[model samples]
Target: MKLLVTLMGVAFITLATQSQSIYSLNYTMGFGVGETSDFIGSPSFRGVTFEGRGFLDDQFSLGGYFSWSTFYEKLAGEKFTDGTATLTGTQYRYINAFPMLFQAHYYFGTDEYEPRAYLGAGAGAYKMIQRVDLGVWSIEENHWHFGLSPEVGIFYPVGMDSQLNVNLKYHYVFGVENSLNYSWFGLSVGFAWGD
Candidate 1:
């Protein structure tokens, strides 16, 4: 995880020194799906995204994307069966996920003053931490999985150098070993600025 962050920092600095680039900071809301929903059925309100894109042409761009999301739920007197043991108690469950990816995007209506729509995809790694607490006992697991994100969004110009950004994204993380796969949908609203 530390290595990935360091590499992304270096890449960001390198990209910033180059040609035209767009950067954004977004507030995100995530809804768990599949196995993720099976573990924590509640939607995640605690999330954020940071992205930087360097233009390769009028319609194509390459970027780096990073996001963090947390999902939590509490169940009272829930029965949990693990192996031959059956436990009934109040359980507190939590999932924290960080996704870092390299992204590519294609834009439409770049020359127009109206909103520009885009299709983008990203591939990279996801760090997931899952925890459950039952009374005095707690079980936690951490895993790293390869992930992909596909999104559709629009950039609405708000000023000379800034735009209002909105996007809907889906994240899919493949399982590792015997681990379970995870998936989610995210809606984001933010501001973007660039040359």
Candidate 2:
């Protein structure tokens, strides 16, 4: 019983020090490409993602994200049949992405409607599945790939732990044999807990 009480106190203290930070889940839909077009489709890529953000102080924040993005490509050199555009010569590329960033936000004023804007940069690695039309060409590129992440976001406080915000992020990778450029617009709804 005494041990349980001590654990409860520790939990309470932790909650007190960590400012109630905001967490969110967002959906990303966009298109992009890199070096080998033979292994992936046109520029139409589809992606879904979830990420979390936490406050380090009133103006500083830290966050991380992971997501899967994929698309299909056609190999035009293969057997041709308009009605039979099968998966025979097409490539399906699936990328698993992980990114972490430290952000600094500037709030316009001391009002509830005060607009907040932030900018930050980070790096990520991708696990890639590369397929080809004539045959299946696949490879997994590890951390040898590095990226630059820049984001601008805004927030409107509703009560405190809740808000509405919009953000734009540009992710450019240089470590891949070919640079993979990805850009996304995010619309988010979120809640803050703890602090």
Task: Output the number of the lDDT-best candidate.
Answer: 1
Q: What is the TM-score of each candidate against the true structure?
A: 0.91, 0.57
Q: Tens-digit lDDT track for model 1 on 96-148?
A: 89998888889996762578999999888799888999899999888988888
Compute the lDDT for candidate 2: 0.47
What are the lDDT figures for the candidates, one per model? 0.88, 0.47
Per-residue lDDT of candidate 2, residues 22-104 (tens digit): 55554554344444333343543455554555555666655554445555554554544667564435433544444332333
Regions more than 4 Å wrong, model 1: 1-10, 81-85
Clashes of each: 0, 4
Q: What is the C-alpha RMSD of each candidate to the true structure, in Å?
A: 2.0, 9.2
Candidate 2, superposed: residue stretches over 4 Å from native = 1-17, 33-45, 74-88, 93-96, 100-115, 124-129, 133-144, 157-160, 176-195
Cα distance off (Å), candidate 2, residue 57: 3.4
